[model samples]
Target chain A: MNDPIEILLVEDNSSDAKLTIRALKEKNLCNNLVHLTDGVQALDFLFGRGTYADRQIENKPKIILLDLNMPKVGGLEVLKEIRSDHKTQFIPVVVMTSSREERDIIESYKLGVNSYIVKPVGFDNFFKAVSELGLYWLLLNQPPKL
Target chain B: METLSIEHSISPNFTKKDIEILKMYFELSKKYNPVISEALTADLADHPLWGPLMKQQTPEQRKAQNERSLAMQHAAIYEGKWEEYSKDLLAQGVMYAQMNISYSDWYELIKMYKDYLLPYIKKDFADSAEKAILYLEGLSKFIDFAMYGIAEAYFAEKNRLIQANEERFRAIFYNSMDHMTLIDRNARIILVNRIPSHYNKADVIGKSILGFQTAENVETVKKAVHSVFEQKESSVFDTAHLAGENKLYYSSSISPIYSENGEVNAAVIISRDLSLQKEAEEEVKELNRSLEIKVEERTKELRDVVKELESFSYSISHDLRSPLRAINGFTHILKDSYADGNEEALDAMDEIINNTQRMGHLIDDLLEFSRLGRAELKKVTVDMRVLVETVIQELTRVPSERKIDITLQQMEKVTGDQNLLKQVLVNIIDNALKYTSKKEHTLIEIGSYADGGNIICYVKDNGAGFDMAYYGKLFGVFQRLHSASEYEGTGVGLALVQKIITKHSGKVWAEGRVGMGATFYFSLPKPRK
Candidate 1:
């Protein structure tokens, strides 16, 4: 409880995921974090299934940093599972990805993602988007206690 | 000595001898028409019926004689002696020979009098000497009167028939519709009616016409003559003359005209000009070709107008969305940061933000859909099995505690625009998650199979399903089957899914019951090898 998981980042692009984590850490928001590179591994961590089966299931993060493009079960699938179950459905989830495709944004909100973020191609815009998303989801927003 | 012998054998009285000679003449002259030997008029020229009378009758007696001959033929006068009859008949024969009276003329005169006199003679003079004597005398006079007239008419008619035939032939030769020239076997123009009469006619008629023809035409004309005259084979040839008004395109064929003995007498050359008709037809063909070009130009102009209209719609959707998106983004920020202790206000503001976000999504979707319509598909064989799994992974990147049991049933890799297919899957799975949010547990499945060379994939969810009544609202831009309060949505997710799938030459649709779950299915063609 002292170091509550503030951000749970799931993405597959090493460069993009690293850049996002770095931007969030620069703002001192990445200390309480759990990062998964793919949807299957991310799913396992959330439900304590597969490799994360030994971990406690009751540990809920304050905000999840989601990337839309990833291998195996992706950001959208993770969002669906989060919103479907009574235990995890109330946790705040934000979609963050390099793709700005219209469907990606609409689907994120439809699945009850608290916010949708598009990773910018340019260095300055990428920094600003990551910093803003981390601040809004982790420090500013209040989380519902389960 | 011969005179004495002939005299001893003859009659002594000159009057009696003359009478005997006339009788012999009369006997022969009674047989008329020497061709058919039908007697019509009895004695002609030397008949005693006229000449002896002419020798006796004064100028004053001539009318009376003509009257009596007419009167006897009419049966009004009948006076004649047997000896006079005999003498008249014999005398007519000699006179007929002297006049050179042909049987044809004698035949005509006899036919004329047959209708007038023959019936009366047959009825009244059948058997008696007196009647016979009357018949002979009447016929002799008729023959004498008719002979000179008939002989002159015959000669005149014969000459006229010959002249008429010559004139008819001359007319055809001079005014023939086809251009004709008569040439001897020597290739000389013996006669040329249509050609200029003064055109060296004397030289051309006897000498070879090859000297007068154009240098090029001379060889052609000679070849034509050899073929048409010597070889006796007819041929047609086209000749081009680009000179002045006399210029003609002549198609001529010559045939040898033969004599009765089958010797080639002359070659008849026939030619006709078709230059004007051919020129008119060529002009019509040129006009039609130009008209076709004009039609094609007009069609291209219409296609350009259609393209302009399509781009106009795309721009409108894009420009209109930016401000609406700002309204949505700012409203959410206000609710989060500044609505302290005002629960109802926060709730109201959340609702407003939600609607604005929905509107923003609608605008973006409409623009994207329009863009896809024009975008050229970049086709590639994406490992779609791995691709869908990756999309599913991205969707689940949010909260860590929710349990999503994803059964990927025999997924197959497919060919498509990789990016578009990923977007399509993301939208569909995300939609299922939104509907199933209230469920105690959620079950989602991503599976694929093949149908008739197309790869079909399904995303199924055990969730709160929409009623069949509102199914029409599915996959339409900004048309939501579920309320925002129940499970939040921009209503454009399925529509965007469908568009992306369609852009990849695929199709998307869904099936569900009200309280059961929904399943989205899409199909795409395998890439051509």
Candidate 2:
């Protein structure tokens, strides 16, 4: 089977997504990645529907990078949606957001997010977080598979 | 007639001088013109007893002849001596007067006649005219004796006059209007002018006052008496005389009446009744007690109402948020899914979202204000100097060139809730920044002091001060001195700050002049926590 797509980044902001993908690639951690901007596109990519209908389900990412405060379904709803499905429930997802509210942190955890992080305010910190996250999840990640 | 019967029966008991004095009284009474003229007719008609003697003698001689001379001759023969004859007659006459008069008047009359007539009678009766005069004197003596009997009647009338006057005085003394009495230092009444029937006629005059009082009243009377004596003053007690079972009285006063030496000789007590005054006082006390109970009950009811209001606000706030959050969260979904890439439409929707967030803030502020009503005040010592610094840091908003330079003065430690005080600082500082948006520069300050036991902290800002007309709206919920368009706020920041400060047992107020910026002040206790 084709190598399962790696690093499925669910982000709505095109500039932030481009900057994130560039940062991950600069670290040589991007391979066979799939990016979807909204909950509809994200669901389709995961379930192999429409254009991705013929896509193999076993070729799935080891972990998902989720962005909250997005269009359509935000990160928390997306986290819940993934956790409820038997096929995707075992996949690890990390939530990142601009809000530092404690409520958001607890809810993300409650929805089975593997980790939660605040979106850094400055460009340098954002670049460093993407580099670190990419190297950990795409390279050295020890995710469970069945 | 009664005397004649007694005399006829007892003539031997009367002596010679008694008869002689009796004859003289008869002779003297007739000599008075009224008696002489009346007896002349009776004589002219000639009484049968004196007619033979009267024919043998001169008429004046017969009228005044020897009834007394015969009685003296008889007394002389009885005594057996002529020299002591008059003395023996006088002694015998005194004895006869005692037996005849029975009381003092007749004896006095006998003595009076003997003193004048005894010597003359004792002298010679041997002269011839004496024999004829003496024989006629017996007839005169009989008339004189009858006049002395009439004099005794007049004496009895004079004694009656003295007794009548004494009875009048006795009536006035026993029935005087005032409770007049003569009392000794021992409080014994020597004389009580009232209630004479209370005493035996003779006993009350010298008896103690106790005789008038029953056993129960004695102790009460004694208490008054002891006070008078101890104070060495005459006292008057107006008190109830509990002589009978149902008796009740109110005493007005006890006053000491003094003698010249200031020693208490007597106490005259006058007691009045008090049932009316006692009843009135009891009525007033009852009214006061009932009024207090009513006030207490009213206060409890009011407290319960306030608690209910707080609970209602709480539930309203909590329940309102659930739906509000759903609206906001779903709006996010719509904004993400349906915005048609039109920048203007997206921006308008963002504005709607921001307004909803502000509405949420307003609801939260309302909840806080009402919650303050139910929350108890908790006081703690707070150092405003460090507190203001921390607040400014949290509210700094990553300080840009638009930052405010708020100079802070050293503040004294004050007793208040620390978290609540921090909110007050944040609200005031943020308000300064919001108001000074149009200004080239912004400034604010914080400080405190010991104003009596209270520490007065103040925040001063150079900002767009509001009109004085809106002063009443300063601390009210959703009240903004300026319009929302002029200043972007939910108009709830100051209200929340005020609520927080109030819950800490502190007071907050503001002062401002148009165009001159504003100063907010609060006073909290500086007592040890």
TM-score of each: 0.40, 0.38
Chain B TM-score, candidates in order: 0.46, 0.44
Real contacts recovered, all predictions:
0.00, 0.00
The 10-residue segment of model 1 chain B with minimum total lDDT is B1-10
Per-prediction interface RMSD in Å = 10.3, 11.6
Residue-wise lDDT of candidate 2 within B329-438, one digit each (tens)? Answer: 44554567788787887888777666656666677667666665565656677778898889888878575777578887878988777777777788888887777777
DockQ (model 1, Cα) = 0.02
Model 2 per-residue lDDT tens digits across residues A30-92: 877788888767777787876678888767788788877667777788788889998899888
DockQ of candidate 2 (2 decimals)? 0.02
Compose the digit string of candidate 1's lDDT tens values, residues B11-32.
1122443344334334333333
